[model samples]
Target: MGRVAGKVALVTGAGLGLGRASSLLLASEGARLVVSDIDEGLATHTAAEIVRGGGEALALRHDVSKPEDWSAAMAAIEQRFGRLDVLVNNAGIAIARNIEDTSLAEWRRTMAINLDGVFLGCQEGIKLMKKSGGGSIINLSSIDGVIGEADLAAYCASKGGVRTLTKAVAVHCAEQRYGIRCNSIHPGYIWTPQTENYLRDLGTLEQEKAKALSRHPIGFLGEPNDIAYMVLYLASDESKFVTGSEMVVDGGYLAV
Candidate 1:
C-alpha cells in the first residue's frame, strides 16, 4: 500500500487529466504531494481530495514556463516538505496545426508550455533532488514524440525534445553520481481533458474518438490510470536501476 512511503512528489498540471490522476495515485501510495497547476482552484481541489483520502498534499498556482514561478514553487516545496523525492513534468499543450499551417506565435506558445516547462522542471528538480540525495524525474512525452503526426507538428517536436532530454538528464545524473533517475513516458491517445479539447477543436468528438480508437489496436483508448501506474513504478524504489529509458504505454499504437 505504501509504494512510495514518506516520499515527496511534485506533479505539475495537477489540475486535471493525467496530472490529477498521477497525483492521486502517488498520494494513495503514501507520498506527500505538491500539486501545482496554472489554475490555483484546480490545484486546491486536487490537494483537498488527497487530504480527504488521508494523504498529505500542498496545492500551488504555478506557471511552468516562467522561471520565477519555478523558483517560487520550489521554495514552497522546500519549506513544506524539507526534501523532494519525485518530480512529474506532466504539464503540456498540443496544437493541431501542421508546420505549413502553424503560425509563428502558435509554434512558440506550444514550445513554451510543452518543451520549456519540462526543461525548467528538470533543471530545478535536479537542484532540489540533489540536495535530498536524488530522486526520479518523470517527463510526459507522447506517441507523437516517437512517431510524427502531420497535424501535430509542434506537439511532436516538443515531445520529441522531451524524449531526448530525458535520456540526457539520466546520463548526466548517473555520471554525477547524484542518485537521480530520469525517464520519459510516451502515451498513445489517452482520453483526457486536453485530448478531448484537442479533438473537439478539429471536428466532431464522436468521429475523432473513433479515429483515435482505431489507431490504438487495443480496441479502445487508454485511461489516465494506465499512465499513473507507470508513474507509481518510476517513483518507487522498484525502478532504481531504470534511467534514461523511454517507457511506451501506447496500447500498441506504435506497432502498427
Candidate 2:
C-alpha cells in the first residue's frame, strides 16, 4: 500500500513547480489530492493529470491570502473528502530586489502571499484538523529564511515569518492535544520557474546557471522531486514524532 493511503491532502499552488511535484507525489502515495492554485486552469489541469494517473483529485482555485478563499476551500474539502489529513502551503513568490530597490507595495505583496497566506492556512488547517482528529502541515520556507540576504529583503522577511509561525502553530497543536503536526521545509536553489526568472535577468543563462551551481557543494541544482520526496515523508505517518522542526533539503547549500 502507498505510504499516505486513504489520506486527504490539500496542496496550495499545485498547478506548477514544487507544488505540483508535491501534489503528484502525495497522490501517487495514495492520498486523495486537492489541487489548488490561484490559476483555475492550472488547478484543473493538475487535478485531471492526477486522475489520469489513477489517483483521486479535486481542483480548486484558491488564493491563500484571503480568509474567504480558505473557508471556501475548506468547505470543498469537507464536502468532497469529509476530512483533511494534510495541508502543504506551497504557494509563494520571491521579488528579486534589495531593501533600497523594494517598494512598500512589493514588501506588502510579498508578506501577503508568503507570510499571511501561511498564517491563514495554519488557522484553517488547525480547525479542520481538529475535527478530523489530526493532520500534518508543511510550510515551504526557503534557506533564505534561516539566513539574511541583502538582495531578497522582502522574501527573507516573509519566509522568516513562516519559519517562526510554523513553530508556534506546532506548539499550540501539541498543547491542545489536537494531534496535528506543523513543520517548515527549507530548500536551496531548486530549479523552478521562480528561480529561473530570478536568474534570467542577471546574465546569460549559462553564466547564471554556473553561478547558481557553484553555490551548492553537491555540484548540481536540485529538481522539484527532491523536495517532493521530503514532503512525502513528512505527510506520511513516518513523521508523526516530528513537529516544530525546520527540515532542510538544501543540497548542502547552507553547509558552506
Model 1, runs deviating above 4 Å: none
> Which stretch of 10 consecutive residues in model 1 shows the poorest summed lDDT?
211-220
Would you estimate the TM-scores of all the predictions? Answer: 0.99, 0.98
lDDT of candidate 2? 0.94
Q: What C-alpha lDDT values do all the predictions have?
A: 0.96, 0.94
**What is the total number of backbone clashes in candidate 2?**
0
Among all windows of 10 consecutive residues in model 2, the one with the lowest summed lDDT is: 197-206
Q: Model 1, range 12-109, lDDT digits (tens) per residue? A: 99999999999999999999999999999999999999999999999999999999999999999999998999999999998889889999999999
Candidate 2: residue 178 lDDT (0-100):
94
For residues 97-189, what per-residue lDDT tens digits would candidate 2 score against the true structure? 889999999999999999999999999988898999999999999999999877789999999999999999999999999999999999999
What RMSD, rounded to one decimal, does every model reach? 0.6, 0.8
Which candidate number has the best lDDT? 1
